[model samples]
Target chain A: MSGASVLYDVPGPKAKVRNRIYSVLGALAVLALIGFIVLRLSANGDFDPARWDIFNYAGVRNSIRDGVLATLQVFAIAAVLSLAVGVLLAVARLSDHRPVRWLATGFIELFRSIPLLITIYAIWVLLLNNRTELGLSDNQPQFWALVIGLTVYNGSVQAEVLRAGILSVPKGQREAAYALGMRKTQVMTTVLIPQAVRAMLPTIISQLVVTLKDTSLGYIITYEELLYSTRLLAGNTTVGGENPYVQVIIVTGAIYIAMCLALSALANWIERRGRRAKTGIGVVEAGDVGNAGALTAAVAAEAAADTTADTAN
Target chain B: MNVLLDYLPEFRAGFLGTLAITAASAVIALVLGVLIAGFRVSPIPPLRAFGTAWVTLLRNTPLTLLFLIAFFVVPKILFQGASPFVLGMLALGLYTSSFVCEAIRSGISTVPVGQAEAARSIGLSFTQTLRLIVLPQATRTVLPPLSSIFIALTKNSAVAGAFSVTELFGYAKLLSDKGYAIAVIFLWVALAYLLITFAISGVFRLLERRMGVAR
Candidate 1:
């Protein structure tokens, strides 16, 4: 609040000034580093017209495009499955039946405890070993491995998020739903889960971002995802050169950054929309309102005077 | 099960390698994470940006990708070779630091600004304020998340097997390649990993309760 800010500046003037100076110096140092890198790169013929021939290789582009698509396919499937799994696990954990709760808890904890990469690797190894007997293909083995691994780990996290969201819902809502003679399942499905999800949309979105980022793990099983494609590019015998490695890495990193930033932007938009949809009654009222408002205003004014007095010393 | 027994020594060696990689990487991650977290919150804009960019880049890429980059790309560019163990540690360290940075940032944010002000008001220097007031509180609040990250780190170290580091899973794979039953060896490997993870989680839970950090 403006009044609160006036009363107690978050960081004092000295610290603020020092911070600004340090920021400017730091920015310049980084700019200089970038400039140096650019100059060195160009001098080393990294940006030469000859090196542009590498992109003309159709196979390179095709593989990358396919990799991108495959990555997206797995990510999309995993996200939806993980969220569904999370919701089921959350509901079961919250069930009135002791066995259901314990089972859900154990499932969530077990999968979540294991490393995601290990889970993926284990599943892949298992599928590969059983493929001949089960009449499955190599691709299915890796694909299923990635999907199941992502689901189990992300689902557990989502369960925790969902549980927190559900607990955050007021007790009165559940009681009222039950009073209406709604069965437990109906109360949960119609009342608790929806409200909890709506309330916890940001956390859910954040987890989704995490899930999207995690899809790159498919690279471990040689799933030919975006990262694997990039690895192929790095090791390309066709584009042999002194230092295509850094260029490939820098470009690949930028692509990843672009996608992640897009996801973050989407999350920000969703958060804004969520805030806009809030009912007036549910909003946390600022302290500078109601009967206490007058007292707070006076106290704030007194605090401001004291701050000024201290600063003038 | 007999297949597992036949390769008990290999499993033992693999378990040790896994433990070594996980512990080494955990130490590196914690130190790297703390430094990066500090840089992220520093008043310096470029340092903060660098930290943020580092976290973003690492978090977005798969851990396997990082390992490949370290093993394949880094050595290629630097015109040197890094052992699989070193490469795995470097990659895991880098990857884990991003999540750890976020955790530390969240923890730092949870510490009341009033606390810092109170420390400063009492004539404590900025360094002293951070060391005594800010860090202790941040470390406490971030314990559970930190523990979870450690467990995740241990699991992720399994990726080292992919690069032929001969860790637990890699060991199991070798046993299978020698015409042994894979399902049996894999189950043993999985159980080994599960046991380690459960033990770590148990310790974490106990610590959390003792520290009154449990919700």
Candidate 2:
């Protein structure tokens, strides 16, 4: 993509001189903001050496490790569960049966409309109150609340994403499969879903990243996850006669940023690998799955492009 | 359901509080999103770098972590006596703004290159080209994604409830703690949120049609 740089003219002699001034001033302004924050934080003991020493403690280190592990455990289960839920819902939404399609639609939209915190808390309470009646393990409410909540919300989102991917597959592929005497289920499973999964891998992975980030919400329900662990450490500790919230924040925040960036980098790498693997289909730059109108247009554009490709072949 | 009827005032307050947070944060996210989008596409390298850093960091960090920082760290390090509502707005707005910036940036990319080149050829400055040509077209086409982001902002405003803002989602705990049934509380709260989200979706649909944005 040539991008939006063409909005400006090429720099001449006077423009070059002005550009230098703007660049210098811009750099200085950014640095100044950074400097101001640093100064303010230091003045508040955030940068005190003692505040930074908490990580050296074995207990603190262990707490963080456990927190990260718990967070990942929840994320792993939720990610898998959500993807499973997504596929089922997407298929049901696409089902030929009217009632089945409407039920899936209703379920997806209902969960999507409600915030996840409410869902998790509601599920937690319901599970707690009905533990005996539902025959559920008592201690598992927090874990299940978080897992089900993430599963439902992310699953709904992924359903839309997968549906978009499915619809974007050229109509000829499904038609060809049907002409070969394939059953509807066979056509969907062997033809549509695989290609849909492949085409929408980037979007699917990014949504997974969202799930990973959202695992932090476990702190809200006292799940003792990463954020909760660090929060306890931050709240209970004292350094140089003051709480080192800023220091804890900086460290905890960095871990999150690092984890997320690593995931994103992996996604980019996989996408690049996919492009190099002689894939006939191109990955559409997917945006919000909730944009049904835009999604329709994008998928249509993709199908048209693939149709033209088929003609050329 | 009777709990909601009995506590109609509390329920109404919670719903209105949620709306207030969403509305306030929506404004902040939009303004910051636009400014950062400009910075991302600007000629100045450092400004562009700053914009990229802002989006990357904010987008990666979870909204809960942001709210934690806003509530805990900011009060101690930056300023004291900052209300939870203000801090929640800043946190939610800052987090959502990254998504907003990305959407707008992609929208910028979708504007036909010929439009920009044509405006540049007419001796228009960068800002002039953006104002007169690029942004108008970009914003028009960008509504669908923008609406999605704002709807996300509305849902995310629920995170504020956990941060002690006593919004709609926070009412979940309140009504439940009062011995009301969880299912009933969820039904009413879910309905309230459905009202907000559907209203948001409906408004955007109206706006999209009014703008005659292309399908």
Candidate 3:
């Protein structure tokens, strides 16, 4: 059987009849649930065009556009800063010195365990309280607070991601680098990290997508990001005759989904490109010459087993 | 320290509230996740498509947006009299279920195909095969990732505080508003979270040691 068929079997005649009955019942159940939800929502005027028409207003459009821009700005700054911090922490965790490694591990664990919202709230309050002493300008503290909280939390996560990637690299590569008289940092930057990055690129990019979505947490602190602005827009009666809370939320949620999907698409493209590049550790054919036939035989045996399994199904 | 003692009742309430929310949402998420995973691996094409769509849609949206929808829209449409606690629970549960489904699906994939094939050959129904032969094996492999999801659920419960749910962060905010030090209050809150999460990690680690399959 193909991989897809492994989890189930092709039904016999009797079983097919039973499965058909099950299929119909299941589909009807799902449809009934959908219909009930739709009827209820319609009863509440949630589907009314007037509520959704707020999107057409110029002021509402501008506010949404500004919110999108602000959200993107925060995401971009946080993404870059977090990646930088992640690298620093990963290096620190991998340091030969015990204290450095412990310190890095402690920081990552502490922030990782804390909720991103609390971090942002704490930072926002801290900055507001110390704004005069710190010489921070108005309106910038919120932005900084969001960015810093994201940086610290996501940086800790990315550090673990990078550390895992680095660890997955073969120890032989690092030994080879040292054998060539390279220093520890040089070995890391040149040999291990480069390969580690290629291996973990998909994970890194996915975490970045996560970071993008997480920018919404700024709403809790009234940072005027996409979700926060949606709330404000929903409350503004001038935009639409109704509250438009449902409509604004749906639109904002769709925008977030669009952004995250785009990031995921990019991650997929890069993953495919990386696969095609095949920049993994090259095998040393010279040393493995004698075992080549054995290796090929092992592969042949595995293929035969797969074919047998397929035929059995 | 004196300030923390003064607000001991608030702190206790907040801690318990956070725990209750996390437990409720975690249970909801686990149930939804298992069903979604079943749909994902089902033979029926429509079921697979529906499962995929649900996971993709829910996963892409932020938890905060989910909460907004739950708070502002869902109650109006579905549960008119539900409290913010219920709304928060629904949002977090729905949002986290996607990740849980993904984890469970991956675990299901790790179960060797031959095992399922064997069960099917012995006249087991698809659901029977999953329950009897597949899920037990998948559960063992899934424990680690499942624990991580719950840990995340614990932290994400903090967002409910934003909706005035009186969770730990909410209590912290209340104290800060009443002339307490912001940094100190936050520090205590963070420490509380750390304690809970670390305890969770310890439990999972012990479970892993006891039940994990040696590769």
Candidate 4:
């Protein structure tokens, strides 16, 4: 086992035993700590089930639901807009024109560096001053500000992800497109982007997941997202000296986890589909045009040839 | 503007608390992140699983919820109760550790497999191999994303305000509650956050250039 195993051997029995011990110890420590806290809370009567009843109360229900809807609305708008903005900037940055590339670089860097909170707060404050002129009131300012701020920051991040994905497409694909007498724009639009995007769909979906979680930042500016709703509910309800805040917080946290897990599942599915379809479409080999497995072999051959050329030099 | 002057003491305390929390939590998270990253890439399945679950939960959930659980739920579950400051630090450190884990793991993965094998063949112990052969290379790859996460943590310190922790934004909220001019108070709060953010980004810029030269 020792000699035959490669340097990065997938794990042996001793390592497995050691891992189990560590896991058990860690789990016990955390559970014990939790137990101690629960015991103390029970002694203080904080753990009484009566405290959680406010969750079922009509006012709390309405506010929480309304908050969820508002959060979803903002997330939907920002996710779509950010992807569009990301692609535009990614393309601009790749543009051969000097000014287009410069402008794109600056825009991405400026928003990417700024904290999302400042962007939202700044937009909120700025809009507040021009509320009447813009035909809006105070409440509208917070909502719009959250949307715009999230769009800018997430959009910048997405731009980088998209650019990396697009650039990751092999040079041969671009050269072959050009070899066919295709224009620069035509090569990008017709040949490179689709293949690059398919290759990078997993990373793109991962960013969208980040965008969704960032929506909770809207709570800072009082945009009434899920966290905000929970806070308002917790504050407005009273469960004696102990505050029913703990139960309400756990419930709300679980909701967020559910949404994030759902997004991850979707991303995983897309990655599988993309993997199956990737070979048949990119850089068509003359002899392997209709055969899927043959296309993979053709690509592998091209890659091996390229490596040989580099080594031969 | 006169309203802004009334809560100067609260604002000062909040501002100082936020800075202290960010610095302390950032340090703790960096250390924890490195350890978790080691566990993640360890040749042990259980360790790898632990690392994976920690990253998945921490990265997936909103930081605000983490703050709440640390401040309210965890305390109720652990000590029956805890101070907002302790809870805030715990939450922020734990939350930041996850991102740190990801960045460091990415950094470590970028170091070629052959490098580690070469270190081992030369008679380096596992720990020595990591310390001498692996980490320096990983640090360079990790700096940019690590800086971004640090900036994020600074902004997230504002969430402590929600738990009644008197960070900068907490003080601003206090002033607003006290009938001070909301705009002026928030403007000052924004300035405080900006000063911290800009300073962190400035340091990262210097590091990036120096690393570029070293490479």
The alpha-carbon lDDT assigned to residue B196 of candidate 3 equals 80
Off by over 4 Å in 1: A1-49, A132-135, A240-245, A280-313, B76-79, B123-125, B202-215
- Give one digit per residue, the lDDT tens place, for model 1 in A85-164: 99999899888899999999998866765556667777787888789987888588888889988898888777766675
lDDT of 4: 0.70
lDDT of each: 0.70, 0.81, 0.79, 0.70
Tens digit per residue, CA lDDT, model 2, A2-66 = 47467787789998899889999999999999998788877776777877988999999999999
- Return the candidate ranking by TM-score, descending: 2, 3, 1, 4
TM-score for each of the candidates = 0.81, 0.93, 0.91, 0.74
Tens-place lDDT digits, model 2, residues B120-211: 89889988888889988988667766766777777788889988996988887888988888888998998998888789879988987887
Q: Name the TM-score of chain A in model 4.
A: 0.79
Q: Write the per-residue lDDT of candidate 3 for residues B1-215, one digit (tens) a residue.
A: 88679888988899999989988998999999999999988876667777889998997888888888898888877888898999999999998888778778878877888898899888888889988999889888777667777888888899899898879989988887787888788888988888787787688789878888775
Arranged by DockQ, best first: 2, 3, 1, 4
Candidate 1 vs 4: which has more lDDT: 4
Best by DockQ: 2
At residue A6, candidate 3 shows an lDDT of 73
Ranked by TM-score, the better of candidates 1 and 4 is 1
- DockQ for every model comes to 0.26, 0.53, 0.44, 0.22
